[model samples]
Structure formats: structure tokens, C-alpha cells
Target chain A: MRCIIRLTLLEMLKKKILYLTLALTAIFLIFYGIAMNYGYDSLRDAEPLMRIAVSGQFLSMGIYALGFIVSFLSIFASVGSISSEIEQGNYDAILSKPISRYEVVVGRYIGILLVLIPYATFFYLSIIGLNLYFGDGVVANIVTVNILKSLSVLYLLPTLLTSVGLLLSTYLSTMGAGVTLVILYFCGMVGGILEQIGHFITGEAKVVLTSIGITTSLVIPSDIVYRKASSILYTTSSGMNFSADNMLGASIQPSGLMLFYIGFYIIIMVVLSIRKFQIRDL
Target chain B: MMLETYNLTKQFNGKGGFKDVSLSVREGEVFSFLGKNGAGKSTFIRTLLGILYPTSGMGLMLGKPIGDVETRKKIGYLPELFQYHTWLTGYELLYNHGLLYKMKKNEIKARIDEVLKIVGLEGHEHKKIKQYSKGMKQRIGLGSAILSDPLLLFLDEPTSALDPLGRKQVRDIIFKLKNEGKTIFLNTHLLSEVELVSDRVAILDKGEMKKIGTMKELLHSPLMLSVGNCSEKIINELKKIDPLLERVGNDIKMSVERDNDLPKIADSVVKNDGLLYMMKRKENVLEELFINTVGEEDVR
Candidate 1:
């Protein structure tokens, strides 16, 4: 199992995409830093409350982009982890060894997480670092100790993606798994928007839209995790749910029950992946 | 017995896989499975190795039931379509396989050197598999299969893609491993290979076992004689030995059940004034057996 984990990590490190992603990440951080510096300077004369609102909104956008990149990376990296190996006949030699099928699925999951966790940490801190380094007095004030709590929630985004991605990988072809996961991810994102819109409106439309959002979250809780993270960050700092005014913000904080459900969702996905792989013919 | 299967069956939707096949391979013996494409030869191997679950029946490898994790520790397999992670170097691939077999790191390190030399890839160990040729990739795969010095090795079409030289190299390796008292279950459609290396051979046609026996029991080498001055007396005398003796242009072809009949055949031909120009047993008797067992139309 350790060998499998090592091999998976080595394969990811050796991939050209990892380097491309890092290069692109460096470019993104640079642009983000420059934007924060210039945007802070432009708001120098703004009133105090206006500065806090604008900086919080700007920081929310940066975190949203960060989560978006990590979510896609997690999905694409793992969607083919099992299915492609099967398609290419790579598992024949490996699986015939003394290791159990459960180890293969779990080892790969750990291997992917081993790479993704540190990466998410670095990217998360970099965005916060840029926000702090280029952040004027207003930006610093809004990023409170609650940022730590929010970062933990942000980590769930990739965890949720990888678990579901691996589950789909066990059942579907690489293309089929990838397409389905991406479509589900899009559904989650659009559902979040509908929920946010539903929060602002009233009557039957509100109930219907919010129900759709909650339903998609039940299918895949990725977007809800992101919203929950955002809510933790902005609401704790500003003493207000800024998403009500800011479009990118979390309008309704995902409940504690949703967090428990996400944990349950991940376990089921991992368990199902192992069970499916064990019973299926490679 | 190193490997045994009793009525082991694996089919996809009740089709295209072996059915009710039972065989046992003894220690230090080379067992060959002969079949055409999609004959369930590979499927049977995979089932025994626990890569594919058997739909019915049972199998044992090294006395443990198939799919038993500990049983796999003593087994090695080179898949018919061998594809390793191309990103790994040859040494890395072997080391990882050894790790999967639960070999100590130091032991795996020591074995990698010997395995590389055995597979004729010593200098190429550090080269990535993607950089290696098809033959080199094959050698690396063979190297991985033999890395743990397994008690039983399963080689499926082990030499299908090699050049003549590469094939001979693999055959030599098989000989070396056999000499060390290792059990080898070889799956191949190559009749010549089966004839050379197998102690016992089984022919599978259309997912059914058509023939199974020792090499001598399966192949009947016929005698082809070039006779000079053949006359009715000589022909009539030879008919006693081979009633179906065929004569075409001074050449006679007939099946001899035993080598003891050779001398009597020579004396009968000579005494009857039929000069014996040449007398030798026919070649490729396995090909004839295979074709007869499985119809020639399905030959691959």
C-alpha cells in the first residue's frame, strides 16, 4: 500500500500538468498581488465602512478563484486514477500481487490527498498572504482569527471532489467518470447561485429555488462547503452576512447538519469505491 | 501440486470464457495452455491469480484458494498484454512489484540486479519504460514477474511480441527457472513454444478444454520415407505396418505408434527391394494435434 501511494505521488509529480499548474499558479498569485496593491491604492480616500466592504468583497473573489482551481485540479487528477489504469491494463500486474483491492483504492486516495493537502495549504496561505501583504488597514481588519476555521472548511472542497471522483472512477470509464463529475460539479455551482438568489426573493419561488439548491447539495455537497467556508470568514469578521450585499458571498451558511452529511458522503464514496473495485473484473 | 483448478469457470454474460475446465500443475513442471484469441486462456489465468473472480467452481495456488492474499505472495504473473506504468524506470517498477510482494527493501534491491541480468536488461534498469523499445518493455515486465523468485509463475503469451532472438532469450530464462524447481504455467498460442518448453499441454477451443495430456500422449510423429524402386511386394509388405500408408512420388507418409517399429519398417522395405532413401519422423506434430483438436478456421 505504501508502494502504491509512493507510485501515485511519483506519477503525479512526474506529470507535466503539475508543473504547468504551478507555473499558472505563480502567474495567478502575481496578478492577484498586483490587483490588491492597485485596488488598495485606488480606495485610499474612501470612507472607512466602504473600504471594509470593498476589501471583504475583493478577498471573497480571490478565495472563490482559489477554491475553483483546487476543486477542478482535485477532480481531474483523480477522475482517471483508477479507470485509466484499468483501461491501459496497468492494474493486471499490480493487482495480481499480494495486496488487496481495498488497499489500492485507499492508497490512491491517500496519495492524492497527500499531494492536494499541502497544495491547498500553500495556495490558501498565498491568497491570505497577498491579502495581508498588499492589504491596507481595512483588509487586515476583516481577516480575523476566523480565517483559520474557514481554511479547514475550504480543505473539504478537494476532499469531497476526490472521494466522488474516485468512486466514479471505479464504476465508469475515465471519460465517463470525468464528464459526470464535472456535470455534477456544475450543478452544485449553479445550485449555489439559485439558493443565493432564492434567499433575496420571497414566496413560492424562494421555496422552490432553495429546495433545488438543497437537493443538488445532497447529490454533491462541494458548493455548500465553499459557501460555508465563505460564511465563516466574512460573517465572523464583519458581524454581518456580507453575501446578502455581495454576489460572490455565501448568502445562507450551510448548516452543521450539512457538514456531518459531507463527512458521511465522503465515507460512503470511499467505501463504495473499494467495494465496487473488489467485485468488478479488472 | 503447485496449481489446481476444479471445474473453474469465468464468463462474461455466459459467453467468451472458459467453462468446466479442471487441471493441475505439479511442482517443477511447465504447463502450457494452447488456444486461439478469445479462447478464455487469459481469463483462466486471471481467475487463478485472483484478478478476476470465478463465476463458479474453485481453484488453488500453492495450496491456498484463489483470491487468498497470502497465497499471492508465492505467485508471479506476466499479463498477456503487459503494460507497466511507463513513467517508472525499469528498476523502480521491479522495486515496486517487490514491495507489493512484501519483500524487504534490501532484499528487493538485491533481487533487482539479478532479475535485470536474467531478463537481459542490466544496463537498461535506470531507463524509463517509455524510453524502452517494445522488446525492452517486455523484458522489464518479465523482470518484474521474476523479481520475487516466486514458487509459481504465470506467464500469459510471454513471448508473443519478441523477435526470434528475444523469444529464445525468454525460453532460456524459462529453462533456468524450471531448472531451479519453479512451477510455470504458460499460456500461449504458439505451438512451437509449447512443444519446446511444456511438460504437459492443454488445448482450449471456444472456451472449452478440447485436449489435455503429456506431450508424448498428445503428439504422434509420423514417419516419412522416400523409397526407391518401390514395387507391389514392398508396398503390400509395408501395408501390414501402416494400412493407411500414403505413397506420392516415391515418398511414403504413415503414422508409427512406437519407435520399436522403425527397424522392422527398414528391414521390410530393404528386403522387398524397395530402397530406403530417407526415413525420419515428421516435424510439427503439435501443430497437427492443435489443428485437429481445435478446428483450423479458429487458428490464430
Candidate 2:
């Protein structure tokens, strides 16, 4: 399994997708860097409160964008990790080894994550460093604890996407899994909207909408994770926003159980993937 | 026994997979599977390797139940038209294969050099698999299969994609592996390869093992005597030696399972005043046996 992990990581690096991802990330950072260097000058010159609001806005947006990039790369790395190889008859030699099916899938998953977590960390933290360095002390107003909290929550996003991607890869073709993941991504977005809808409605209608949101959350907790991470920015709040009160996962107050449930979702998907792949004809 | 299958069948599709394939291959011998396209040769190997589940019966590989990790560690496989991770360089592919077999890093490094040399892929290690030619790909595949120096090696069409030179290169490697006391289960359509290397051959036709025996047993050529000016007495003399001797066209053909019988037939032909135009043993006897077993239509 260690060999698989090392080989898979080496293959991913050789494909240079990681480099391309980093290049895209660097370009994104450079664009944001420019945006901060000049675009925030006027905001900084304004009242201090306005500057704080502007910095909060960019910080939240940057976290979401970074999360999306990491999630995309993680999915791409894993979506074809099993199904495509089975189609091409590549697993015969590997499975003939002295490793279990679970090891094959887990080794691959860890390989992708090993690359992903570090890349996500670098991108996630660099933007923070850049904002602090370039934003004329405006971005420093958000508590460091909040930034770290948000970053930690944001980290789960890709791991969750990769699990879902590998789960679908177990039974579906590479393209089929990719398409299904796209639909699930929409479900996650809709889940976020439903979570928002639960805030404004009341009575049985409120119960129904919240139930639907909860159902979607259980089915695909990735969107719930995104919302919960945003809520961490302002734990005292219930809505998803980049306000100073909710700038670092503070007030939106989703139960810790939901986060653990998301983590469990990752484990279940991976286990299911291994079981399915173990019995597949290829 | 290196491998023993008792009624091992994988006919889930009930269309093209093999059935009731029971055989025993002793250690350090080369056993070959000869069959036409879709004749269940690959199916048999795959089932034995546990890539495909058997619907019934049992298989024991290296005296352990099939698909056991301990037994797998003692086995190697080169799948038919197998695909390699193309982005991987040849050396990396072998190295990774070694890792899968749980070899240490330094052990894998040493084995990679040895395997690459054995497969005649010395300088090509650094090149990525995608850039390799078809023949090169096959050689690298062989390299990975032998990287662990497994006790039992299953090579399916190990030379199918190679050119003549590459084919001989593979044949030589198979010979060398056999000399090193590896039990090889080879699946190939090349009858000549079977004749040259296999100690035993199983001819599979339409998912059935139609015939199987030692190479001498399967290719036991029937003595063909081309004669003219033959008389009834000469025919009677030949018949005495081989009760089933038959005259076809201008010659008398009979199974001369013993070399001593050859002399008696020649003496009978001359003493009885029959002109022995030729008394030659048929070459490519395995080819003839294969065609006879599988039928001529499928061979073409």
C-alpha cells in the first residue's frame, strides 16, 4: 500500500496537474495580490470600519475560492483512480499483489490527500499572509483564531469531495461519476439555500424546509460543511455571511455532531468504494 | 503441485468463459494453454488468479487457497494485452510493483536492475511507458511480473505484441525462468512457442479442455509412410505393428509411439517389395495436433 501511495503521488506529480494547480493558484494569488495592493487603497483610506468590512468580504470569498480549487483537484485525482483502471485492465497485476482491496483504495485516497492538504494549506494560508502584508493593516482586524478555525473547516471540503468522487468511481464510469458529482455539487448549493430558508420561515413550513435541508445534508454533507464553515466565521449568527461577527466561524452555530457526521460520511463512502471495487468484475 | 484446479469454472456469462478446468502443474515445469481467440485461455488464467470469481469448484495455488495474500506473494502475472500506468517510467513501474510485493527499497532497486536486464530493457528504464513501443511495453510488463522472482508465473500471451526478435527475447526469458525452477503457466496462441518450451500442453476449444498431456504425448506423431508398388502382404505387415493403421491417399499413416516400431515398418515395406518413396515424421506435430483438436476452421 505504501508503494501504491508513493507511486500514485509520483504519478500525480509527473502528470503536472499539481503544478498546473499551483500555477493557477499562484495566478489567483497574484490577481488577488494586485487587487489588494491597489483595489483596497480607497477602502483603507475610508473609515476603519469600512476597511474591516472590505477585508472580511475578500477573506470569505478567498476561502470559498480556495476550497473550490482544492476540491476540484482532489476529485480529478480520484475520480478515475479505480473505475478507469478497471476498464483498462490495469488492476490485475496490482490486485494480484499481497494487499487487500481496502488498502488499494485507501492508499490512493491518502496519496491524493497528502498532496491536497499541503496545497490547500499553502493556498489557504498564503492568501491570509498576503492580505496581512498588502492590505494596510485592515485585514488584521479578524482574529487569528477565527482564521485558523475557518481554515480547518475549509480543509474538510476537499476531503469530502474526494470521498464522494471515489465512491462514485467505484460503480460508475469516470465520466459518469464526474457528471453525478456535478449534480451533487448543485444539491449542496441547494442545501445551502435551504439552510438559509430555514432562518426566515416559521411553523410547519419551517419544520419542512429545515427537514429537507437536514436530509440533503445527510445525503451530501459537503454543502453543509461549506455552510458550517461559513457559520464558523460568526458563530453567534445563523446566516451565511462574511460579517465581522461571523468572519471566522463564530455565530452560525451548527452542532458539532454535524461536522462529525460529515467526517463519517467520508469514511462510509471510502468503505463502500472498497467493497464495491473488491467485487467488481474487472 | 504448483497449481491444482478441480472443476474450477467461471461461466457467469454462460457464453465464453472456461468451465471444469481441472489440471495439476508441478513445480519447475512449463505448462502452456493453447487455444483460439475467446477460447477461454485468458479466462482460465484470470479465474486462477482470482481476478474473476469462479462459479463453482476449487483452486489451490502453491498449496494455498487461491487469492490468498501469502500465495500471491509467491506468484507473478503478465496479463493479456495488459495496460501499464503510462505516465510511469519503466523503472518506476517496476519499483512500484516491487513495493506492492512488499519488498524493501534497496531490495526493489536491486531487483529492478536484475529484472530490467533479464527482460532486455537495460537503457529504456528512464523512458516513460507512454513513449515506449508496443514491444517495449510488453518487455516492461514482463519485468514487473518477474520483479519479485515469484515461484509461480502466469504469463498470458507474453509475446503476442512483440516482433520476431522480441518474441525470441521473451521465449529466451521464459526458458531462463524455467531453468531457474519457476513454475510457469503460459497462455499463448503460438503453437511453436508451446512446442519449444512447454513440458505439457492443454488445448482448449470453445471453453473446453479438449486435449491435454505431456508435449511428447500430445505431439506423438503418427508415422507416415509414403510408398508405391505396395502389396497386400506389406499392408498386412504394417497392420500387425499398428492395428489402426489407415491408408490415406498414397500413404499409410499409423501411430509409431515407440521408435523401435519405425524400423519394423521400413523393413516390412522393402522386404514385401514395396517402394518406400519417403518415410518422414511430420514436423510441427503440435500444430497438427492443435488443429486436429480445435478444428481447422478456428485455427485459420
Q: What is the interface RMSD of each candidate, in Å?
A: 0.8, 1.2
lDDT for each residue of candidate 1 in B265-298, tens digit (9 for 90 to 100): 9999999888899999899889988888888776
Give interface RMSD (Å), model 1: 0.8
Off by over 4 Å in 2: A197-210, A233-251, B227-240, B243-250, B260-277, B295-300
TM-score of chain B of each: 0.91, 0.86
TM-score of chain A of 2: 0.87
Worst 10-residue lDDT window, candidate 2 chain B: B7-16
Sequence-dependent TM-score of model 1: 0.94
Model 1 misplaced regions, further than 4 Å: A140-144, A235-244, B229-275
Q: Which ten residues in a row have the lowest lDDT in candidate 2 chain A?
A: A243-252
**Which docking class does model 2 fall in?**
medium
Q: DockQ values for all predictions? A: 0.76, 0.71
Residues B158-241, model 2: lDDT tens digits: 999999999999989999999999999999999888888999999899988899899887776878889998788888999898
